[model samples]
Target: MARTSNMLKAAMALVLCYPLAIAESEDDFWEYDVRVSEGYCVYRNKTFAAYVDYTLEEPCEKWNCYPDDQMVLEQHCPPPPGYEIPSNASKDAWPYCCSNSTSS
Candidate 1:
């Protein structure tokens, strides 16, 4: 026997290449950052948390050494129905709302 026919052709080439190497493609590779809880803030992964909550000229930017045990993240304003609150608001406005782009 040729070594059991070359070990059955190397086990049929590892069972036909094992499903193309386990068909992978979870965005191939990626990793933004930013993630919080309680008050909220997710960014990178995007969805909610007011997209990085309040800020003061950049309240801790990403990849910018931001993380003093977490800061800014207590957004809460007169926002409810369809949202609103942006009359030249500053002073690190919380829950910056603006629903339908029809500024009133």
Candidate 2:
């Protein structure tokens, strides 16, 4: 009967669409608790290497003039001479220094 044929077609359509729906659900993946701190860093091996220098020395002073001598954590890499600096260096917006408190 046509009713049986329609029901079969409907089930076939749903079976075909089920995989596409499952594929879309995978796109919602996300990472949580990604805490980033502002600090100087260098890029090595396709990853950012972080360093914190609180000396308030010459090069850092040029970037920001603050008397507090706060921890200067910037993201920079020392490439070879004449090598172009990467424009996509990571710079954390929230600047935080290493604290004596271990809770960080």
Candidate 3:
């Protein structure tokens, strides 16, 4: 009887923890890709110089090209609740352009 109770408790613990594990994994938003050689990275037929960081306005993403030929892409998430972009703010600018607003 004690063994059965322990097994049930363990099963319940795992069930409660599973969703937390999945959520944690979802927090990893960066996507990685490898290039054929140790040089520049290309996207949409455009070549990005090696060992530099670039931002795209259309998709609101920041990507980096490493000398080792690895590209890391990070897509910026939308502004959180209560966040707003001032009319004067440059939408073309990433991250820095978002600000918290009290009005809504």
Return the TM-score for each candidate structure: 0.19, 0.19, 0.42
TM-score winner: 3
Note each model's CA RMSD in angstroms: 19.8, 22.4, 14.3
Residue 21, model 1: Cα distance from true site in angstroms: 39
Give the number of the best model, judged by lDDT: 3
Error of 1 at 84 (Å): 13
- Model 2 off-target regions past 4 Å? 20-104
When sorted by lDDT, best at the front, the candidate numbers are: 3, 1, 2
lDDT of 2 by residue, 42-79 (tens): 22111222322222122211111111222122312221
Q: In model 1, what lDDT does residue 63 have?
A: 18
Task: Give the Cα error of residue 45 in candidate 1, in Å.
Answer: 18
Better of 2 and 3 by lDDT: 3
For candidate 2, the C-alpha RMSD (Å) to the true structure equals: 22.4
State the displacement of the C-alpha of residue 52, model 2, in Å, after optimal TM-score superposition.
54
In the range 1-104, model 3's lDDT, one tens digit per residue, is 86566445533543353333223333323545646243677655556775344655545554445434254444354432333344664556543422331211
Model 1 lDDT per residue over 1-104, tens place: 86566445533543353333223333211223456565454554433443222322232121111122232222222233333334665534333322221221
Pairs with backbone N, CA or C atoms under 3 Å apart (clashes), candidate 1: none
- Please list the residue runs of candidate 3 whose C-alpha ends up more than 4 Å from where it truly belongs after superposition: 1-28, 36-38, 78-91, 96-104
